[model samples]
Target: MSADEKGDFISNNHQVQPIQNSLLPIQHNPNDALPSSSNPRRNPRNMQGLLKFLLETTKNEDGTHDSEFSPMDEERKEFLMNVFESMSVNIAEKLTESLKVISQAVNITQQDDPSDCENALEVLTDLVDEVDVANDFMKIGGLQACKPCLYSPHNGIRWRAAQLVGECAQNNPLFQHNAVQLTFLDDLIKLVDTDTDERVRVKALYAISTIMRGNEKAINFFHDIDACHTLMRALQSDSDRLKIKVAFLLSTAFSGDQFLKIQLQKMGFITLLVQLIMEALEGKKITSLEHLLGALISLSKDLPDALEDCRQPNLNFLNILDNIIQTYKDDSACLETVSYASSIKQMVYSYTDVINADR
Candidate 1:
């Protein structure tokens, strides 16, 4: 009786213990932090989250140090320098990852929903304005990705792309060179040539101005492609800004090679410029007038065959000067006017010597 009872009781206890273990709920810790893979706070799991975090850090109220995104703030440089340094090691990879997200959001085909495009472009603009990031931006296909946006049916996207592309080419030689190689220059020429939007045209022209600075090869390329003609036509527009930019572009091209100056003169650029100067003086748009004056002075300073060109019987630069003088005879007290007068007089006197010598 004792042996049978003991065996039965031991087997029943073992079976009961197994059932109890299977029935109990799995033990877990409520306070344990989740893995970064599962937690958005530990790591941003999506583009919106990352963008929000970045935007928050750029605000002064974020309590980090200072705002980095405010263009007018003094702390922007320090903040940008710090971020630039931190990302310097793998900036291209890091930026590429972020831009991939931004690209989708800012795609031109995003229909009428532009909230993402606006925010992303603002971020990109701030980043590129931080100095050397523009080169890195190009390295990461940022410019290529946005190229189509330049012609977005929506003006906002086109304008944003225009601004971003201009900044991408800002004072960055490599970026500018890349632009030329990648046919961005051709795109820019098209924008300036036929885009109906004046704002976009001006921005593209500004980018062309930046890209062509001290770049003789690019200037020559533009000249070879007949882009000079497009620029010259742009000068005919009534928008003073566009005219100033076109004049500036001509001045830059003239500054590049002597042949460019001769070519421009042959194309009647000098005649058109003189007419523009007279119009500027009459319109009283002081800034436009000054820029036009600067362009003429820039051309005069750089044109290798200035005296030779002035000697052309058909040019009549002295007559043009006389017309300007007759137009501004009473403006003796205006320093700018007087300065222009003196400059034109010097040109006439110099050209007169050349003419007399030819005789």
Candidate 2:
């Protein structure tokens, strides 16, 4: 099925891709001692031992590293990745036990150390990124374990927790559905509404975006929570990071829902999207042009159908879409694909035929 047709699809190129790179930086070191033939670390039998050592080393005993982990030095994170990658299957198999330790470090019920939780989330996020552990993670109550951290007093802890949840929800429909069932998305929306920290808000918005991705049920749940208004407020933020993420969320959620398309246009999202594009054209903010265009394209394709039953349409996004396509045709080749040009071209002709038939 095409991306737009899938029930749980998010573009492979969206900000979710960055979460893979955001948590870990793995580069083999020439002087590292873990890979030697005689190195005990090479033994897969020692994987669980390695995991325990990591947890002990990272736990904060006296707030010495409340702001960060002194033990999680570059050498340590690299070593952790090295060992974890070597035994991903075994670790995932033992994920329930491993989660006990990992969760204790982060779970507010088990620990209150923000630094420990932050560090634990970092490690867990990196692991989830490396493997399809969403089911295993959720199976072991990971969703419940991580939920409290979203409101942690520490910005880093909250940020990392939010990032981890979003990564888990990526491309996993069941996980997304479970997240909604557990009201995780509502908590995240509440984070967006109340968090004073921009970093935390951005992460929360990104997670909501991921959980809502292409799941029609989740998207409907989003409306039930009145998240569209929350997203609109985010779109007006001065932070381009927030704007790009919320715009991309709209694009992903807009892919398969016809009802949402009408609701979104009624909220004036099409005009806001066009304004974002115009800002990019004027070189005011260049970071989100591709995502903004993607959202506009999704909207363009839906507007005609969304408003087909209206007695008198209030606006002509088709005309606006035609101008956008013409204006950006030359630059479209530089985007992720030329499909935007072709898709909009087809939309223009389709709308033209409908209008001519009426005339």
Top lDDT hit: 2
lDDT of 2 by residue, 163-277 (tens): 9889888887777877887888888888887788888889998888788877777788755527788888888877788888887887777667777777877777767776666
> Which pairs, if any, clash in model 1?
none
- lDDT computed for candidate 1: 0.63
Candidate 2, run of 10 with poorest lDDT: 14-23
lDDT of 1 by residue, 33-126 (tens): 3224355333223334344546754444656666445454665456445533433334344355546645664345645676566566656666
lDDT of 2: 0.64
Question: Backbone clashes in each candidate structure, one number apiece?
Answer: 0, 0
